[model samples]
Target: MTDFTGSMGYCEFQIPFFIEGVRVETSQMLVGTEYHEEAEKIDRETAIVMPLTKTKLQDKKEDLNFVREDIQTSFVQEFDFPECKATLSLFGRADKVVRKKETLIVSDDKHVSNPRRYDVMSEPYVGQLLQVLAYLNSKYYLGESFGGWKEIPCSTKMYQINIVDSKTRSIYKTYEEIITEEHAELFLDYTSKFIKKCLELDSLDHHNSKPKCKACGYFSDCSHALK
Candidate 1:
């Protein structure tokens, strides 16, 4: 979903790699993967098992009591939207899921080589936002039994982490926004159309942006890559 939404040619260009079970890995991708693995390990080791009563669970919905619950990080979730026949399912992993006070927060962590590159941007990229929205929507509509709460307010967050220098600037910025059912519907509609177009081999040309092409892991092997 992120690739299809972020880059014009990524989905088409990656098809061969996927078929061959070859992942194009860059240094940045490796670093991000390592960091997430370490974080997940630590979270698992230090996670607390808390017991909740029926009254406390009810209070959680009404915001009557202050409760904090940290869900397992990097847990995979699948969302099935039968209404969109073209692309009936989507899957994503949320970096963080927490219920603080009255709101459920879904966060995605992005590890960047340099944080200064995004200083001009006011918020997260559209693809990043959508990724988190997918997680939020899945949890809201389908995770009542797992999450132990329902009909509560939900929001999405993007944490931009500076991988190069954590002491000076660990977290560069946090982009946040409220997510709703309408947003989820709109996302599903867009994704369905996008998948249908991909199936028809429509607009499979490279974006032709030199910077993007150079940064792409598949640039060395991609036939359509910009020189």
Candidate 2:
């Protein structure tokens, strides 16, 4: 969903690269990768894991009843939906899940060179918002299957951490109404159209933004890239 909303042009330009399993690593990508690796390592080292038994679930619920925050790492959810006569699997891994007082706050952390580019008061980038929404929506639909905490309310959050200055900004939103099956179906429709376009390699549909083309990894090799 992030790729489809954020970088459809780039994805289309690099279709051949993706098919051949070739990745173009940029300096920015390397830096972001390193930051996530270090963060994940630290989180894993400090995280406490407990078996999800009935007793444990109750204990955890009681523990979270108070105003407390639990940092859950690599929170993953997956679901399968029928789309266009085929089953489409949607999966997302949230960076952190905070069980705070009857609310499940799904947080995604983004490491960026400059944090000033993002504004916390405004809505997050379309792709980022959708990515977080997908996680929360799936949790809502799957109910208590994964954990018994689905009864709690769900919210979305984004942490934009600055790599250079070590600064952070957070954007929070509660999208209860948008988490319905109707919205999920709309998202699936967009996904289905995106997949079909990818399969057809629709050259005419490429983004014509020169700034985006210049920043794309496949700019040099993409014939449709805007000059």
Candidate 3:
């Protein structure tokens, strides 16, 4: 197995969060130009969607940290759903790892037309979430540094905020922090791209309707509305 935490630093700005494919972005989060310098550039490029086709690692073994405590690795494989992709992160003290033979539960709704929603918040495995994130980080930064369409989840519980140039790295708040949905969905670069994607999908359906089929959600908003 590859040990990613040998001597390198922690992931810069990514937090632990999951994606439900569709994302949303607004103009309210356009601060901290320097903090999001790298991420902003990455946003323009096309993402090479990651394919974690492999199974999640099941580790029941315990690791003794420097704090003089035996911490057990209690998580087997992650669950895969049909409708939406889930990224789970579990916290708490567990004795050992546990892997459910059955696929973990996923959201039931397949027609998610909205953004800023996650399927794993209700129920998810922490181990699976970490594994998937590590995989994505490896693919995005370790091997070939680039962007892609693979949905990513991050937790910014432990992060180091730094900026190389002035105004490049400024701290941005979330909606909850700013008391508004617009701020909660701030564009910190990494998430900005996803939010932009969601906007594109929304705009396309609103403007150009290639087919006059009844399945279109924006049929009412389309130019050629059927009476």
What are the per-residue Cα lDDT tens digits for candidate 3 across 1-227? Answer: 00111101112111111122222222322332222444435533534433322122222122211110112122222334343443322222211111123221110011122222432344222222323223222211111222332222222111111112223232221111111233223312223333233333212122232452233333343345443
TM-score of each: 0.68, 0.62, 0.18
Off by over 4 Å in 1: 1-12, 15-22, 52-85, 139-169, 180-182
Top-scoring candidate (TM-score): 1
lDDT (10s digit) by residue, model 1, range 113-209: 7777677887666666666665655533224453533433433322332223333425677777666567667666656545654455345545557
Task: State the displacement of the C-alpha of residue 20, model 1, in Å, after optimal TM-score superposition.
Answer: 6.2
The reply for model 2, stretches above 4 Å from the true place, is: 1-16, 54-84, 139-186, 201-204
What is the descending lDDT order?
1, 2, 3
| Shift of residue 227 alpha carbon in model 2, Å | 2.5
- All candidates in order of TM-score, best leading: 1, 2, 3
Q: Tell me the deviation in Å of residue 21 in model 3.
A: 4.4
* C-alpha lDDT values of all predictions: 0.54, 0.48, 0.24
Best lDDT among the predictions, by candidate number: 1
Looking at model 1, report the run of 10 residues with the lowest lDDT sum.
Answer: 64-73
Where does candidate 2 clash, by residue pair?
Answer: none
For model 2 the local lDDT of residue 85 reads 36
